[model samples]
Every structure is written in structure tokens, then in C-alpha cells.
Target: MLSYGVSKSSSRVPHIVTFCCNNPHHPTTTHAESHSVVTRRALSLLATATASVFSVPVLVSSSSVRYLEAAAAASTPRFSELPESGGVKALDLRVGDGDYPVNGDQVAIHYYGRLAAKQGWRFDSTYDHKDETGEPIPFIFILGSGKVIAGIETAVRSMKVGGIRRVIIPPSQGYQNMDQEPVPPNFFDRQRLFTTIFNPTRLANGEGSTLGIIIFDIELVSLKHL
Candidate 1:
């Protein structure tokens, strides 16, 4: 009868030991010697398996690091370009529900106006328009009536109610030739500075003639068909 038992070796390694009172073996080996050889072989296999198990985590750890680095690079925002529409580039920050406004519709909006030439100098914002009670006042106008700048009107016409959009207006589609009402608080002062730098020679030469290039973050609050 052969029985198997677990025993610890001098090296403190655990392995399976076979015990046999009388067992067939090589002519040079006794039953006890065969048991010892079997135990050593078992220990070697277990040690190799233990090493293999620990090595897996090292490979997974390196792979996980690479995955995290790729995720971080993908998360970085890029603003080198934007979609253009009829020479006026527009980017929708939030898409709204409901029907789109059309010509003759009474539309209400809020906006933050900035000058591109002044490194995005904020000139005005509807958020600043407040009543005596401190409630916000939205700017209202009739669509397609030329009540606002052409670029803003064009951008709004393409938006749905409650949508928010950011537009970049070139000088041709901006405040050129228009002393738009509800002007900036420092419009006159800005005009004085603008006049000093206004160059007709550059204007005719197709250079930087007009400093009217502006940016606007506009949100269409609501609209009513008139």
C-alpha cells in the first residue's frame, strides 16, 4: 500500500511525500530513496508554479500604466479649430430642445460680448443687465429685422430655443459700419482708441483694417412666433 502525505523539507519548502512499505523501483534505489526523489520533484514544480503566478501581476501593472496615460492624453481639450458657417464660425456649447426660431419670431437671448483683438477683452454681458429688484433682463429682438449684429442674428437663426452657442465673427460680419445701440459701457473710449489705430491704407490693402472682429457667447432663452 502507498500513501501520500505533505511534509516540509530542510529548505522549508512543502511538497508531497510518498510512503510505501514495499514498492517496485530501480535496482539502485530503495523505496525510501524513491520517496525522497518524488518529494523533491514535487517541490520543484510547486516553486516554478508560484513564480509564474507572481510574474502575471508585473505584466498587468505595466499594461495598466500605459492605459492610464492614453486616457489622460485623450481627455485634454483641443481648440485649434472650429466649424465655420457662412464665414462665421460657430460652436454649440449646449444643444437645446424644441423648435427652431424663424424670421419674424420674437426671440430673447443673453450674451457675453468680447473683442478678439484685445485678447478676448470682455466688453458687455446681458448678465449685467438687471432691474432695480436685481432680476436679470434678457435682450429681446425680432429675428431677420436687423436689430442685432449680422453674425449674431445669423448664429441665432441656426439655433433652437434654449440652446447656447459661441460664435467668432470676422470684421465684415461684425460691428462694422454700425453704431449698434446698447453699446458697451466704454464704447466711446474704445472708439477713440480704435480711431487712432484705424488705417484706411490697411483697409484697402486687405490687411488688418478693421478691429471689429468680435466673439459672443449667446444663449437663446426662448422664442415666440409673431
Candidate 2:
């Protein structure tokens, strides 16, 4: 028979081991083999625990990275270029629920006009009436009648009542070249819109040199047949 007793050693860190055997006739493990077995078991347990601890953090990090990528994709603003060569690039912010307006149909709208900028300052709005028209007074106009610029007219033609759109009007659809002679009665009364919606400040401040592209946030309020 063989057995081990608990005993204290001089070292502060103590390693304890206990073993017992009922029959001495059968061969038993040597101290080196016993220690080897214990060491292997401890190493296996440590490997399992380390893998378990580190695996959670790696999985969590991967999941967080995927979540952030999805969020960024969803939150990014969408801007589309027009398929046609000459048309304006219209971006629908909110699609309207009612029907679109036709040519000569009287349309009521509220709009905010601004120079396209990262921090675009509002040049004019129906909400504030920069040109002497009463604020919030809906601008009533006949569609497709040369009553407005080509970009605005094209945008409203596709909009339903209550829809909001942002249209980028190129110089061809906006103020003509300043160096060139004044155009004939073509696009509607630029003077009237100037007095109502557009702020002449850009021209006054000499910021309207080429007057390249203008941006309008327009909402269709109502439509009436002529």
C-alpha cells in the first residue's frame, strides 16, 4: 500500500499533491509521471479557459464592426446624376402622395433657394419672402408655361402634391451667361421670381459671376387646372 500525507514546506508558495493505492503488488506511477499528468491537465484547462475568454471579445469586435458598417451605409446621403444629358439632377427627399401636374396647370409651392455649399446659406424662401412677397404666401404659377426656370419646371412636373424635391439646375437651366447679351422672353419673368423668391444678393455681391448651378428645395402644395 502507498499513500501521501499533507505536509508544509519552507517555501511561501506550496504545491500540494495526494495519492493512495490499496495494493502494493501492482506497479504504480513514478513521481515524475504523476507530475507530468498533473501538468498536462493544468495546461489543457488553461488553454480551454484562455480560448473561452479571448473568443468572446473577438466575436464581439467583429459584430460591432459589421454593425457600424451597416449603419454608415444606411445613413449616407444619396445623390444621383441624371441619365439624360440635358436634364436636371432631381433627388427625391420625400415622394408625394397625390398626382403630378400637367402643362398649364396652376401649381402652388413653397421653396428655399440657396447656393449649393457644404454650409449652404439660404438665399431666399417662400417661408421668409426675400423679395417683398408675404412670407408663407404660396407662389402660384402655371407649369410648363415658361413661368419658371427649366430645372424647377422639370422637377415639379414629376412631383405629386406634398412631395419634396431637391433639384440641381445647371447654368443652361439657370441664369444665362453674364457676358452674353440678355435673353428674350424665354424662361418666365426672372424679375418677378427675383422680387419674390430669389435674393439678388448674389448678383449684388458679385458672387453671381457665372451663376453655374442653383439648388432648390421645393414642395408642391396644390394643383389646379387652368
Tell me, by TM-score, which candidate is best.
1
What lDDT score is found at residue 149 in candidate 2? 69
Once superposed on the true structure, which residue ranges of model 2 sit more than 4 Å away at CA? Answer: 1-62, 82-87, 117-119, 130-135, 177-210
TM-scores of the candidates are 0.58, 0.54
For model 1, the local distance difference test gives 0.63
User: TM-score for model 1?
Assistant: 0.58
Residue-level lDDT of model 2, residues 1-226, one tens digit each, is: 0111333331121232334455576445556455545544433333333111221112123344354344435544565655552657877877889989999899998787665532454555666533555435666788877747677777888889999888887767764433221122223433433432234676576655334467788889999998
lDDT of 1 by residue, 100-203 (tens): 99999999988887777667776777787789999678888898887577888888888888788888877667765536433554667456435523556655
- C-alpha local distance difference test of each model: 0.63, 0.58
Clashes of 1: 0
